[model samples]
Target: MTLTCIAVDDEPLALGLVSAFIEKTPFLKLVGRYSSAVEALQGLLTQTVDVIFLDIQMPDLTGLELARVLERSNRGAHTTRIIFTTAFDQFALDGFRVDALDYLLKPFNYEEFLRAASKARQYFELVHRPEPAPFVISPAPPQPVEAADDYLFLKAEYQLVRVAHQDILYIEGLKDYVKVYRQSDPAKPLLSLTSLKVLEEKLPPKRFMRVHRSFIVALDQIDAVTRNSVQIGATTIPVSDQYKDAFGQFISRWL
Candidate 1:
């Protein structure tokens, strides 16, 4: 499926380059192009875009501010994904905080732009994939018991893989799937076709905690806690205001 997108940048040259990149991409269709964040925000109100190639810095409104506005406006269901295109590398963390699909550093080549665009394409494909048919049950089998509860089985791709609870660093929820980051495999996370809420119910409360609407962290794996974020290995997960108090209490026990 082709993804409808928009390009927002104050720099004429930068905007032209991004728009061109989107045009050349096989699966991306450019729906709008704006020179400022304010103008882009207005365009978004009427446009049904699937992705946005946004610049982080602008005179009137920054990309981060506009991202927050979109986040609030699209609270539930699948919201438009963002791919931040900027010169600054420091805003990388802020980009993830707003759940951007990807980030492209300025002056990047077509290869880099295509790589980021591919991620957005994969995300939309997952979101729009057809549902599986219901299974018919046979006679009930005897339930096995007396096994250790440290590990659980999760369906990733087409296989059910066993995952240890302690090995999980954090879990990030996408539209209809959750990425399970594990200590054993830090580079690639296991993608499961399950909701965060369902996993939240299955995981032990003492070992895991929901820190944000889109994030759940393994309490034992958190290396450090900041005022509004948690550090786990190389990744920094934001703690939203909704769960701040509960997470703060979790920190208090260790302090």
Candidate 2:
């Protein structure tokens, strides 16, 4: 079966790259392609796309910014799986806030693309299958994953990094990925992860909160709030329309 997909990028060369990559995959059907997020948004309004190859930085609206707007609309349409294709590695943790399918770095090889495609296929299969009876990956025999409740160990290139639930600033969901931010350095800090939803389920909700689609700042960690931004330490996170009301209520109830 052909998977209907859309490719959006501001750069002409990047657009050509996506076109070339799609040509190699027989199962992928290029339903549409756009040079700007505005054009892609128009396309999505009328047609149904199974997947979207989105670029983060654009002239007017970025890939991340557009997704936030669409989700806020909450239209009655089939949800499109987002796949973020970008060169910015630092935003990996923030991408997770939007429940992305995967994060593909720029100038990706076919093998890497295939890996992401394979994962996407497996995801759809798992989605179709009935929910499993709580899975566990401990030293012991078949047991539910208990570590999920405690804390998630984020790997930041060097070694195994452990982050407590209270340390999270917020998660940002990219096209097909997510990013995680925790309490750390200002100019340089710790971050790791490629999926937001993946980490959200692992966090303890009593302390963690999804304040924005691109952010899940720790309630107690927030130092100030502007009209459209939340200040957590030195970080200024955007609160998109999709998460405004929910995040507002979350803060209102606590304060």
Candidate 3:
């Protein structure tokens, strides 16, 4: 799972360094970078980020102050993790007081940055990991002489769209939205304001499987299944550890 993150620092060099480091890290997707805490705070209000690489010392709104505000704004379970980056080591205690995950002493190497990032990644993975749904077998119901209607009506672009179940190649999950990709026109995807979990329940379990946290692929649309990924058309989706066991059982049937 990729973690969406933003960097906030008053110094140009510090901001650029964190931005570059985030770019280099595969799991970290840079959503936005700012040179001031005010701008970063505004961006946070608009975007759903998983982590923040913030510099503790800034004019007007220090990272500590911003963290306090964020703590108040986003209380309870879905709070964003913070990693303070500062030249002074004295602020380390203050960083922990605000529940910062990790801190980086400026002029640190890439390895050190990666270690801190890894800690944040582990924390998120533990907290936000998907639990495996209980699988059970039920007695088959009486068959209908005529096949039941196999289509879903989804609301998109202010219109109710009828989509055939078999036409879907895969579904990608954005923060609060899901993009349904169809085999008919791979170029266009129908965007709906729904969660992946909701679609997972709507789709026939026999036809689709959740291979990754962000992806649910059509079993018949899968052209290949590698040791770590599944190929549908030109796209290769990773099979995360959380769903690997279920996928393995599915593959065992035909293997």
Q: Which runs in model 2 stand beyond 4 Å of their true positions?
A: 75-77, 129-255
Stretches off by above 4 angstroms in model 3 are 75-77, 132-255
What lDDT does candidate 3 reach at residue 86? 93
lDDT per model vs. reference: 0.88, 0.72, 0.86
TM-score of model 1 vs. true structure = 0.61
Question: For every model shown, what is its TM-score relative to the native structure?
Answer: 0.61, 0.51, 0.52
Q: Quick one: ranking by lDDT, best first? A: 1, 3, 2
- Cα shift from native, residue 86, model 2 (Å): 0.8
lDDT-wise, the better of 1 and 2 is 1
lDDT of 1 by residue, 1-255 (tens): 899999999999999999999999989999999999999999887768899899998998999999999988954675788899999999976876677777888889999999888877876776687987655666898565444678877766333468999899999999888999999998999987789999999899989999999999999998999879999988899999999999889889878
**Among these predicted structures, which one has the highest lDDT?**
1
**RMSD, model 1, all Cα superposed?**
10.4
lDDT of 2 by residue, 69-123 (tens): 8667776645667778898977655555555677888989888876766555555
Ranked candidates (TM-score, high to low): 1, 3, 2
lDDT of 3 by residue, 104-207 (tens): 99998899999988878877776677986764556887455433447776645423467898899999999877899998989999987678999899888889
Model 1 clash pairs?
Answer: none
lDDT of candidate model 2 versus the reference? 0.72
